[model samples]
Target: MDLGVKVDNLPAEAMMELAPRVEAAGLDEFWLIEDLGLAGGFTQVAAALERTRRVRVGLGIAPAAVRNVAYLAMEVATLARLHPGRFLMGVGHGMPEWLSQVGAHPASLMAALEEVTVALRRLLDGEQVAFHGSHVHLDRVRLAHPPAVPPPVSLGVRGPKGLDLARRIANGTILAEGSALDYIGDIASAAKGLDHRLTVFTWLSVDSDGDTARARLRDTIAEALVHPAMSVQLRSWYKADLTDAAIDALAVAGTPQDCAAALRRLADAGADAVILQPVRGAESAQIASLAEDIRPLLDAG
Candidate 1:
């Protein structure tokens, strides 16, 4: 039940300021959205690292389609070097539109990701990656300035095969299936009792104003409009009037007590940490409120 929250908006100076407040709240990590559409992930990460002292800063899975395995490994290594043990990396196969928008070829996504994951780890170990892989290779390249201590890796996966890949390769696996707890058993079982962390990402809104919470969720839920798997899961879980065909149940919008209670449910289910991805128009007050309220549940559990 560790509380981790996403950071998408805030001024350059405000980002640095965000670190102290986030740390003060006893959050396990600051999950920065390396949102390509909004800002450079590295840019915000550097700022977060510079601004915070002990709170770990993690990229919320930089799209593997956006960069090659070599550059990706270098970037994460650089972040770790800059902040020492305070840096972490995660990777995800992003949406088709974002992949196409960047003109990055992401076809055969499963194969592509499998290759990327192995190469990145090799580079992190400061070894020359000489794989003759289809998607990624180092040939003779190695990390010039590698991390003194290897940071952790988490996979952003929603499907079965992706979950299996995570179990095979990553230190931990993350689930973002728009609130469907149906797959937790399948995902957990795949881990085979490996001492790996499990994370679940969901939309979390907390305010006394109920209508305002729902209003904020509408804008955030739009992406599910085009994703069927997400839509089906949401419809099955809470019977939400899930209009979006694509978006699953990644978001949870409700009053403070209700949201807090739901977070406890995730911990009770199996997640070590619950990443709070607030959709459009989310505010820091929600986090501030959670720090004031929900943390006790985790400690008690």
Candidate 2:
């Protein structure tokens, strides 16, 4: 089980500054996101890869509707060929609003996702593909230089049906932020009988004092509060009285021991990898603690 950090909503300059530090810290991976109005995922990852030799770079997801499947295959293959086993590329049905704004949202999102996954997998495998599905169309395309060992294509998705689709077509699934242990269990159950990797993001904040660490996670907690899925899980799983103060308890925040316990719980609940998404302004410290303190604890246990 690998432990990693997500670099999101941060400036490119800030990320570049952090990349070498993340590498020096002995972190397993540093994941990036390609949101509607932010830096491009692949390009940013390429820069990180260039800056670091040890830390693997991952794209949390690229929207399947935003680009041609064949082209995406080429991009991922080129990066994999260049970096070998150091890149992880994922794709998904993007946020509906982002897709609609870009005029790329399909009428049937599930169909589109399935089409893209199937075609992308074939292309990555170095096969000549001529796919004509409801959403994706290709014309006998094949990568001239495919990866010798293709990186797993993960589907960034949520809900039971989405998990099922990912298990059927893609090698892995990326759960959205705020997914709890029970939610991960549900995904694992749905993916039973299939060999699928599960990578989940959790809100993270680590400080020497528990109170300070919890305080740093307020914004992340507030963001999770609005998520309908997370709200439901918090209510059912914790069965806690949902107070403002109590809500902060949902995240992996507190002292190093506390954070390590939270991570162990998630790994026990069936996560192949857990990417800690630190709140803005707390990334560097949280990442350092993740590698230096939390991971050593997990390993020792």
Model 2 alpha-carbon miss at residue 7, Å: 1.0
Tell me how many clashing residue pairs each candidate has.
15, 0
Model 2 vs. true fold: TM: 0.93
The whole-model C-alpha lDDT of candidate 2 against the native structure comes to 0.82
**Any runs in candidate 2 off by more than 4 Å, and if so which?**
229-249
Give the local distance difference test score of model 1: 0.71
Model 1, 31-58: lDDT tens digits are 7766656767777888888877888887
Q: What does candidate 2's lDDT look like per residue over 1-301, in tens digits?
A: 7878887888888987888888887778889999989999888999999999988899988998888888888899989999999999888888888899989989788888889889888998999999888889888899999999999989998766777788888899998776667778878777777788888877888888888878676655665666665554454534444353453446687888988888887877788888878868877877778888887888899
TM-score of each: 0.86, 0.93
